[model samples]
Structures are given as structure tokens and as C-alpha cells.
Target chain A: MENEPIIEVRQVNKSFGKNHVLRDFSMDVNQGENLVILGKSGSGKSVLIKCIIRLIDADSGSIKVLGNEINGLDQEPLDDLRSKIGFLFQSNALYDSMTVRQNLEFPLRIHWTKEERLKNGYSAVMEALTDVGLAHTIDMMPSELSGGMRKRIALARALILRPKVILYDEPTTGLDPVTGREISELMVSVQKKYNATSVIISHDMNCIRITSNRVIMLIEGRNYADDTFENLKKSNDPKIKEFFT
Target chain B: MNPLSTYIKESPFLKEIGEIALFTKRFFKEIAKPKQEYAEFLNQCFWIGYKSLILVGVTGFIMGLVLTIQSRPTLVEFGAESMLPSMVSVSLIREIAPVITALICAGKIGSGIGAELGSMRVTEQIDAMEVSGTNPFKYLVVTRVMAATLMLPVLSSLANAISLYGGYLGANIRGNVSWNLYWFQVFNVLNYGDVLPSLIKTFFFGFAIGIIGCYKGYYSQKGTEGVGRSATTAVIVASLLVFIIDLIAVQITDLLGLT
Candidate 1:
């Protein structure tokens, strides 16, 4: 599917009352491309991602994922569509009341076959944990895990579905520099291994430089820059420079 | 009324009305969605129902005993001591047991679910579900609602049985009502008309608690503070809904001449 775009967000506009978060924002990701979105806080980075996933409805424009127009789909098909994409939130978003195993198993149990769930599930969970270097802590609760471990568990959860696309919303925001770099590298490695389209939302220059092949910046509720990191840095716009600096 | 107080009162009242309307719309939208989360349903039943048996059982026994003791002397003053068994059974099965059990559940299960889902919302776990192609509402709302609906009736049934036993213990503490005679009086007055409608009402009570809790928690904004608010509001609203629904059930039953 190299000739086809995996996710296309076209001219999307989102407004929460008078505050317009995304104004005619547009972007695209081809199959297996790792696209990182760079924007300061409140630059509509998250909202832009949310609109693509239909988590937050766009007031106007279109979002087509896997060749399906997601905007008009009902809940059943919407859920079907959602099952194809994996999302990692900034907080890691693990279910605190459940064990780490349960957290990893939740989505699988919800969507997969019982046999597939019980038989393949354990190995999948272990594989995902090992992939993230957290194989020893399967039974531990989320509250018991450190920040980096939590992010890893979240990554494992995203991998459970073997999704076509993975969306990371500030995946390494709160980690220490070393941990954050490690996470960025893991993200790159995972995307490469799965050959999955990855859209990462971050303002961190290091994360962008390390993981992204292409960077898109959202400024003043629209696409301000969409190019390689090198080209983005060379853009003469002071606002874009300020964002990079 | 003072201008400030008047505005405060009106603003909140209007806000509440708006919230109720929004709640109604969302509830309808959710119901209209066809895909059901059966796994979540079973999981919640296991969590909210099976796990809560001990708490409800203990509370039910104590409530029965206390209510029996409290009501006995009044009946005795009127020389209606023999009426104790029938009186206690009717009250426990028809109103007290179900209502009390629900309030207990609202506090226990409702707040627990609210806080759980609220924190999920605060932490963007719900958003994660959205992106991963899971209907968070199906996984969260349907399961919790179904659990509450099915479990509340079971809990109330169990509570009613224990409460009657508690009443029996209370009666035997003083005078001479045989176990056979006490049960004879209880079964004599209690019928499907009395029990079924009451049982039916508990399902609605359970549903109200589950839906309100999930709704409050799912839509919670403002992070940790939102979670606390969702939990507190869920319990309060669910308890109030229990009484309101109970009142409506009672009226409907009376209108149908079931009582």
C-alpha cells in the first residue's frame, strides 16, 4: 500500500466556542512513514490528531483513514476503524485499578477472539513487554511502575492490536532526558519493525530530530511548515524559528 | 431575593436543566449505537456485582434487625404484635431493602466506577481508547449499566432475605413468634405483585447509578479535580435518582392496582 496514503486529514477546522483550535489544518501520512508534529502547547497539535481519530469532531473538512471517510461513519464502523489504530497518550493512561497484565490485555480481550485472546495473548503481552524492556514486571500495577515503565506499558498496549497506524501524543514528555531519548529511539524502532505509520505529537526538538523523517508545525491554528527538519530550520519566518529555538 | 443570591440560584438551576437535557441526548445517542460491549458487561458484573456481595449482605442484615427492633414497640402499643412479620417483610421487600441496598451500592460501586473512569478521562486513557478503535462508551457505559441493572436486583433480593431473617431474630429476642408462623405471615402478604415491581424498580436504580457515574466520569474535565467532582456527583445524583425512580415506580404500581 506504498502508493496509497494511510491517513489523510484535509482542510480540517475545529473550534471550541470562540477559540479556534484548528483552522483549515491539513496533513497526510503514507504507509510506514513516521511523521512528527511539532507545536508549542495550545498550538492545536493534540486537537489536530484528535480530529484525525474522530475523538474530537472537526467542525469542517475531511479525515480519511485507511481509505474510509471517518467523519460520516456510525459508532459500529467507527469502532471497527478505531481497532486498526493504536494511540499512546502523554500520561501513559494505564488503568490504575488493574494489574499491568490486565492493562495490556484490556483491548485484546475487548476485540480479539477468545482463543486468540487466551493463547496468543500471553505471548503477545510478554513480547510487547520485552520489546519495551519491561518483561520482569508483568504482574505489577500501573501505580507501582515508574514513569518510563508506564510509557512502555502504554506502548505495549498500543502494539497489542498490531495496528496499521500508531499515534503518539507527547510520548516522552515527562521522562528524564535519558529516558526520553530511549523512548524516542524505541518509537523509531517500533515503527520500523511493525512498518506502521506513526504520527508523533511533540514540541521537543531532540525527539523530532531523532525520530521524524518529516516534521509538520501548527502555528496560529493552521499548517505553518511541512518539510524536513533541515528545511524547517532554514525557513525565514521568525515565528517558525522561535518554535525551533 | 437579593440580586446576587437570585442570580446564583437561577444560574445553577438553568445549568442543571441544561445538563439534564445534554445527558438525555447523550444517553439516547449511546443507546442508538448498535455495537454492545459484552466482555465489558461481563467484567463489570463481576466487579460491581459479585465483588459487592459482602458489603450489601452485611448492611442488609443490620438494616433488617434495626428496623424490626425500632418498629416492634409501636406495633405492640397498638396490640398488633402479631402483625410484625408481615409489616417488616412488606417494608423490607417493597421499599426499604431495595432503596437501602441501592444507596449502599451507589456509595460503593458508583463512586468507584466514577473515580475509575474519571481518572481515565483525566489521564487521557479514554482518548487512547478512541484512537485505538475502541468505543469507550461501549466498554465503559454499557458494562457498568448492565452490571448495575442485573446486580441491583440480585443484591436487593439477597438483602430482602437477610433482612427478613434479621426481623425474625429481632422478634424472637422478645416474644413467641415461631419461625413457621413468621414465614407464614411474610409469604401470605408478599405476592408477585408486591415483589416483582419492587424488583423491577431496582434495575432502574442500578441503571441510573451506572449511567450517571460513567457519564460524570467520562465527560470530566479539569484533570484530578474533575475526577473528584465526578465521583461525588455520581453518588449524590444516583442516590437521588433511586428515590425519584422509586416514587415513580410506587405510583405506577398503585395506579395499576398491583399493591
Candidate 2:
């Protein structure tokens, strides 16, 4: 990975009325690295990821993604910026009324031209599904799939655009251990294949261990700790040790 | 006393009204943008218009039949049984048909849109669309509102036609009024003023139903309970707005000397 940062969050703060969530948080995500954010439930991990994608505006701060200031862009330019960033929602957010193929085709329909889609849409969809090992389920509705399969389909949809940055919010939260590990493994392989930078929000230790090049602990709405999984595990601070134990 | 209850009752109403006004403004702004969502708009037209025909048709037929039958005795007492078709046709076309059709749509299409979009919101599908660089509001809201505005007028027209036919059948039930004479009487009493104002009002009714439905759904929170609340609230608000719009339309028509 290069020394240049792909994402820079500076002194970000957010609050929902009286309940402050993010308290002047700051972090940097370098290019071509898998950075996992670990936090307890309701620790603002999801909010942090949302801020990075401009899905949720920070109360105060500056966030730069791919060298563009997120807060300053207009709707059209923001949309264009978003096309280069993929997000895997915790719920998968697959359109239940549509088939997996249609769900996968949705992003391309928005961002790609008719000629471009006609030339490469099917092949692109096939490649994404193949990467997630769910090519057979293309015509199936999301309701027909198991949780793990749905996660895989969501991952495939995220990858279809060949995005430079993928934001994964709890990619393996609801799956069993084996399936979770499988998803984690796929995350690593997909990272290598696409050379895509990833910021994963997760509390699953196994997921963090398997997928993260570095881990950041979000505690009290700040970057409480930053280190590798092994080093973080060896830390003696009570809050850091709480996660490892 | 309960200060919280007072705040809950008073604040949410004012707050919701303000929010709905803002939502409506945003919808207008988004709709004015280029590259309308045509495919989704057509799909919504099919769902909201074509699928709603049977219910509106049946209700209108019954309304016309009942009105004719109920008025028959009074007309008989006045020795004006011949006036039955004119009276029923005027009532149906001038007011009953549009109101009934809009109410039915409020119950059916409004609730359906609210629940569908509410569930999508809760499940994060809307957010997912936004994150994927798609304009979910344009794709979801504008098309639905436009479809409802255009389709309700057409549905009302169809319902008015069916109701006249129903009035004909009711006229034949107790007397030997020929179809030709019945329709002739009906047409003689009708004019452009009677039809035009009623038709114009229905477009507003349709717009209200669609906008309220979308507003409820698009901003829903608190998960599944919120979805149910959105559907129920959409129907109630749209149904109420239909009457309010009808009342205003009546006053306008009266002032314009169309009534």
C-alpha cells in the first residue's frame, strides 16, 4: 500500500439531540488496506461508516474520500463519487420484490450507459456472482436465499461496479461461524483480486482477525485504540482487553 | 398533569404538518429535474390505476343504483318519476363518483405505497439505492404521485360511466323507462360545467393521496411497527384530505357559478 491516505476523517462530531454519538473522532484509511472498526453495540460504528459515505452527515468536521471533500460536493457530483464507492448494508438491503439478477443490475442501470451495459452487463454480473459463489441464484428472489447466501449476493452486488472503495457494515453479523469465516475469506480474496480499499465495521473478533490489516477501536465515540489484531489483543488497557477477552 | 402528553399531542401534529410541507416541496423540486423515471412511472401506473379498476367500478355501480332506488319513491310522490335519470346522473357525475373513487384509492393505493416504501425504508433498501448513486426519491415518489394524479381522473370518468349504466338498470327495475329515453334525459341535464369542475377536483384528490402516502412511507422509522403506522396513517390522512379538497372544490365551483 502507498503512504497516501484514501480517506481522511478529521475531528468529526455527531449527536442526536442530547445523546452525543461521535465525539471529535479522527481516522485515516490508507489505499489498498482492510481497516476494521470494532465497537460494542450502539458504539457508533455504523454511524462512522455512514459518515464516510455521506449517508449521514457529521454534526461538525471534514471528511475527504478519494481526495474529494465529502461535505462540499453537490448532489450530482456526490452521486458520481458514490458510484465509485460500494457499500454493503448490514441488512443486505436487497430489493425483495426483485430477483438477484435485477438487484445486481440496479447500480449499473444508474451509473452505466445503455451501450455499456448491453456490451458487458451480463458478463459483469456473472463475474460478481462467481466471485461470491452464487451464480446459480441469479434468477432467484432474495427471499429464497439463506442468510449466508443473501450476504454473498449483497457482496456480489457491491463488487459488480468494480468500486475502488467498499464499505462493509457488519458483513457477517447474522451468519453462523463457518459462514462468517467463509464471508471473511471471500472479503480477503475479493480485496486481493480488485485491489480495492475496504473499511469494515464489525465487532466479530474472527472477522477482524481474518480481514483487517489494522484495527481501530471505537469507544466513547472516538478512536480509542489503533493497532494490529495481535498487538491490540496483547494490550493491557481494560477497554482494549474487554474486546480481546 | 402530564406535560409529556401535552407535548406529544401538540408538537407532533405541528411538527408533522411542517415536515409534510417540506416533503411536498422537495418532491416538486425533484420532479422538475430532467431525466424523469419513466419505467418506474409506468409500473406504478399499472399498479395504481389498472389494478384499482374493479373496486372503483363496483362501488360506483352500487352507489348509482342505491341513489336511484332511494329517490324513486320521492319522485313518484311528486309525479315526476320521469326525472329519475336526470337527478341520479347529476348527482353521480357532479360529486359522488369522484369522491368515492378517491376514497377507494386512498384506502388501497395510498396504504399500499405507504407500507411498501415504509418497509423499504426500514430495511435500508432506500439507503442502499442512495448509496448506489441512484435517486430513490425520484424513482419512488415522483412517479407514484404523477401516476395517481393522472389515473384518478380516468378512473373517475370510468366510474361515472358505469354508474350511469347502473342508474339505467335501476330505472328499468320499477318502471318501463327505455335505455334511449333514460340516457337522453341524463344528457339533457348535463353540461360542460358540471363535468369539468368535478373532474378538475379529482386531480387534486389524487395528488393529495399520493403525496401523503409517499410522505408517510419515505420518513417512517422505528422498524416494523413504524411500517404499520405509516400504512394506517397514510390511509387516514389521505381520506381526510380527500374530503377537505372536496369541500374546497365545492366552494370554488359555487363561487364560479358552476354548481
Candidate 3:
């Protein structure tokens, strides 16, 4: 809950061949801070997250996570570095071949404890599911769950690893307002409980309102505005105003 | 130029070459790195190995039966009807069953892994994996390749046995070869060389299919349509690689006087 930033991006750039998706984008995520990123479709919001995780290599600029430079690190250390961050995909990205329990157990099995020490892990999964209000559907397949439930399961999976930072990509995009609000509330509550840093990518105003104490608007791969929700609402920039309108 | 050779020459060789190059590149990248996602790998193996048994089994049996039946008349004409079981077993062990099984796997398991991974790629699950500190390639490619390499040989072995059974059925339908005599002749002609080399080659075929399919799918570009295209292309490319690898294996083994 201190003002120490856990994630820092300095002028990162990425492009697919000729098409530039992210250009000179920089942002900071403080420890225990819930920072919601608002951007229109294809504005490179997801790319920013991708750059942070090193999924897609950045074309230029340096990214530091917990004061460690991530861009040039070898695969082993990068993977070790990756174990500390949790990602909740927009589609939930649950392995359709696995049941919910299997899905939650997957990351833990790989990155955490072995099978013998799996009780704390199981309880953590159940705890995450309960936090997201999905404690009853432990054995269900991803295909069998509703969209909201799937997202919850994905959140549980992400949290099961007990990561320091959780990056949620379009968490509430596909859900109904009620479900979406519930998700936003869950994110906020989870952030408070874990005292973990959160970076959410969404255009949903409700998500921004509920989850973000700090909002950063990305317009055309650069920060359009960086402020609290109220200030973003009152900003005189036409594009920013138009976005709210 | 003759029609068949000309057609082969005129086929999309460059596209195939590009695909092969891409596949090789992706495989090296996957192996040259770390970030092993064991959970995802085991899951893939379960899908690619455990679920594919029935299809490979059925095809293996049919291939044996059909080849035996078709070859019986030719053998009978040469007064070599007694060689039917041996001939069928050799054919199944050396070529038909392994290749056919691989083709089937390319169609079933290969394309499935391809499409699933391709779709995951397009939808940003792969990206999510990376940002979350997971290596998509290790999690996606190595597990799948390892699964295919391990499972395909087992499937091929099973296919060979079933195919011999099919040959027995086909031989008994009209021929005079008894069960004991048929198997005895087959065993008499069979050597460790014929069986082992062919079996050894099948592991490569499995590896090729797994790698190529995974490569095509993992690097799949575009969106939903791209995923579908990647799946189809993965099967086609992996099947073609199986043939190429088989040809190379034959030449190498021949040069070494093993086959």
C-alpha cells in the first residue's frame, strides 16, 4: 500500500512488420495500486501488457519490473520472473481440455509446490473461487461454465499462483452490467485483500470507476491523460471529453 | 513434361518451402529457450496421445486388411500364396501402417493441436501467457512435440499388430495359409533390421508431425480465419514432412546397408 512502484515501463515500442501497434508508451504501476488503463479498440492497450510480460518482444525501450530489467533476460530467469505476475485473460483462456480444478492446479503444479504440498494450493484455489463467488463449480469444465463463471475461474487460476502483480485484460468486456460490476467489485476486493498491484485494460467506464484509483488513457500508443477518475472526467482535452461523452 | 511430374513440379513448392522453413525456425526457438510449462504439456499429451488411440487403431486394422486382400491374387499367380502373411507383415511393419497412422494423426491430433493453439494465439491467450511470465513456446510446443514423439511410436506399434490381425482375416477369407504357418513364414522373413529401422523412423515422423503442426499453429497470424487456415496447413505440412523424412530415412538406411 506504499507509494513504491512495482512495475515501470520506459518508452516501449512494438510493431508488427510495418504496422506499429505501440509507440513510445510508458507507464508506472505502484505496489498495491489498482491502475485501470482505458483505450479504444486496437489502441495497443493489450500490447502494452504483452510487452511487460515479454510475450512479444518490444522493438525498443526498457521495461523494469521490481527494479529488474526484463527485456534482455534469458529464458530461465524470464520464466522465473514471470512466475511472480498473474494474468487474467479476457476470454478466460481456460484450457478446454481441463476441468476447473485442473485449470487452477495447472500453474501451481508448474511454478509452485509439488503434489504432496498441494493442500495449501487447493485451499488457495477454493479461496479464490469463493472470493469470486464461484466456490461451487470446482469440478466443471470450462466449456460447461457461463462466461462470467469462466472469467471468475480464470481469475482464480491467476491468483492461485499468488503473484505480486495481476494484469487483467478486458476483464469485464463481455459480461452483462451486473456480472461486470460484480467482477469489478471482486477485483477491488481482491486487490485490497492481497495488497497486490493490479493493471487492468478496459474501455468499460464502470470497470474504471470501480477498480481504478488511478486511470491512464492511451490514445494512439501514448498516454492521453494520467490522473484520477474525477480529473479525467473534467479534463478539457476534446478527445478525452469525447471519450467520456 | 509428363502430366504427373509436371503437376508435381508446378505445385506450390515455394509455399511449402516457406512453411518448412518457418516450422524449423519455430522449433529451434522453442528448444533453444526455457520456460517449461509442464501442466500445459501434460494436458496436451493427454489430448494428443490418450484420445487418439481409437482412430489410429481403426485405420491400422483396415490398412492391413486391405493390403492383404489386394495382394493375395498377385501372390497366388506367382505360386507364392504361402508368402501372403510374411509379405503383409513386412509391408505393415516397414511402410504402410506407420505412414498411414502418421497421416491419420496429422489429420486428427496434428490439426487439433494446430487449430487449438492457433486460436489461442489469435485470441491473445498466448500473449497473456507471456505477460504472466509463462513461455508460450515451451508450454505449447515442447509438450506437444514430446507427446507426439512418445505417443506415435506406441500407436504405430499397436497399428502394426492390428494390421497383422487384419491380414489374417483377409488371408482366411479365401486363401490356404493357416494361422501358425502364416505367422511362422512372417517371422521367418522378419529380422530386427526391418522392424527396428522402420520403428525408429516412425519416431521421427511423429516428431516432424508434432513440430510442424505446433509451429504452424503457434505462429498463426490474423484472427479466427487465420486459426482455421493454420490448422489445415499444419496437417498438410506435417503429412508432407512425414513423407520427406521417410524418404530420407530410406536413403540413409540403404546407404548404411541396414534396410
lDDT of 1 by residue, A1-245 (tens): 78478988889999999998998888888889889998889889988877778888899998999999989898778878888888888888887878988888888865788899878999989988888899898999988988998999999999887888999999889999999999999999999888899999998888888999899888889888899988998888898899766
Q: Which candidate achieves the best lDDT against the true structure? A: 2
Residue pairs whose backbone atoms clash in candidate 3? A53-B131, A82-B133
Highest TM-score scorer: 2
lDDT digits (tens) for residues B115-204 of candidate 1 = 988989988878776666666777777678778889999999999999889889988887779999999999999999989998899999
Error of 1 at A94 (Å): 2.0
RMSD over all Cα atoms, model 2? 2.2
lDDT (Cα, 0-100) at A105 in candidate 2: 97
In candidate 3 chain A, what residue range of length 10 has the lowest lDDT sum?
Answer: A110-119
Error of 2 at B119 (Å): 0.3
In model 1, the runs with Cα more than 4 Å from the true position are: A1-5, A234-236, B1-36
Residue-level lDDT of model 2, residues A89-202, one tens digit each, is 999999999999999999998899999999999999999999999999999999999999999999999999999999999999999999999999999999999999999999
lDDT of 3 at A135: 87
Rank the candidate models, highest lDDT first.
2, 1, 3
TM-scores of the candidates are 0.89, 0.97, 0.88
Superposed by TM-score, candidate 2 places the C-alpha of residue B250 at a distance from the truth, in angstroms, of: 0.6
